[model samples]
Target: MESWGNSTTVTEFVLLGLSRNPQVRAGLFVIFLVMYLIAVAGNSLIVVLIVVDSHLHTPMYFFLSNLSFIDVCYVTTSVPQMLVHSFTERPTISYGRCFGQMSIAVCLAETEFLLLAVMAYDRLVAICNPLRYSLIMNGKVCIILALGLWTFPVLLTLVTFLTLQVNMCGHNVVNHFKCEVQAVLKLACSSTRINGIIMVLASSFTLLFPFIFILVTYGRIGFAVLRIRSAQGRGKALSTCGSHLAVVGIFYGTALAMYLRPQAKRFTNREKVMAIFYGVITPMLNPMIYSMRNREVKGALWRVIGRKVGK
Candidate 1:
């Protein structure tokens, strides 16, 4: 009887997606559908172009291809579920699947954190020590970095695991588009101190640490460029850093506001909006950011198109 009682409680959760209004929901469905399609296609194209174009197969493109692939997975992990809930009147998800989404999201977010850091280090080596760049970020080193990106995130899985311990008491409604961490934790009747602490600690490691590393790398790159005598060389170096800084600003700004600022104890409508900004908008724009900022990417894209047209 005790086991059954515990099991039956909160069998599933209802996600009160973006809106209840028919017009708003219809509009949102189309919007997210378009965003998803573009994000996948754009990122996949980046990956494929890098692989096929021998000139593009450097450490930077390797990391970029990995980033593109992760963007596909990260967006897929959340957007499809949101799309499903948009049209359905109920917008419900089972308990297992809800937590499952949380776990996957954590994994992807952590992986991106480390991958971005490795990319920063790659840039640091490239700009600050151009002659030794190949020796430092060789194929073997890059592979190890990629492997660690995927493997070292088990520490974050504990957040969702701890979430399972919270007692939902059979009431099944989550007031957001997806199974966001803080939102789901709100449903629990028991103490959530551990979960909250885990969130903060995890956020600090994944967000703060990588951010600090990137800043230090840029600092080094700045000093290195100042030593260059040619004006054109300095401009080229600054431009590369500018593109990466833009991505970092968008990603960290929204993500920190959404997760870290939730210290107020509840996930609010504002946080949902912030989530949409980082979760959907940022990923969609990443490819454009890279391609538009870097001339090489644009040239490679045209070459690929030209090859296809020639055939």
Candidate 2:
């Protein structure tokens, strides 16, 4: 153990993952491994499809590629660490490494939230002001928005991380598998009130704000769809936003369930399961949800595959 600040000693964290039972661990390993593989393959395919298909060279797919990339990063942050913990009898993380993991996880999570918000707004502009969609979401504007989404998370994570550094001293046995902000803070010998407050505020911005924006955007969209005189027109417009709505529902529903309440020791296993949904399962599902349901994406993917096979 190493002393920090005044005289507090900090060492490593013990990650209590899914199960101690070998059989259970094996089962979970298989399940999670499948989820991880799907997440990587699905998200990668989306990125490739978007890049190679000229038909997908639009602001929507541009945002989607970014979203898929973030999803890949997001799942990778936690799942691999958890997998290691599950197999190994003794799993430990160094203080510096734990902090770094926490920082990256939080940053990527916030980035995903911001990206979702940007996508929502893009849909809003596309649906509400169809004529102005091109002007509103031009390449330059998209780049600026994307930069803002990426930068804000790093700044927010830095603030939270700095606050955490002050508290990280003494036996760091993080009960959770991953380096969660709450789990790490619980190990601190020093005061963590400031860290808790910052977490709540950041969570509000990242989770709740995007949720509200999505709700309002979709509410308006629903009203607009109802007003369309032709059923075909309404169907067409609704189809455009359906995939995004599905993604938002899954991502936000799981996130709100996990973070809306106070962190509890008893619910650690439950939290881990829920974390799998948003962090791993959702990412895997996003590409499939969009590609399978959306005609344009499916068409583009088919064409790309056909071209490759031909060559």
Writing each residue's lDDT as its tens digit, candidate 1 over 136-178 gives: 9999999999988878776556644654456677667787898
Please provide, for model 2 over 100-178, each residue's C-alpha lDDT reduced to its tens digit, 9 standing for 90 to 100: 7878888988898889888888878887788999998999999999999999999987776555445455555666768
The collision pairs in model 1 are: 10-170
Model 2 residue 37 CA deviation (Å) reads 0.6
What TM-score, over all chains together, does every model reach? 0.93, 0.92
Clashes of each: 1, 2
Please report how far candidate 1 places residue 202 from its true position, in Å: 1.9
TM-score of 1: 0.93
Error of 1 at 309 (Å): 2.1
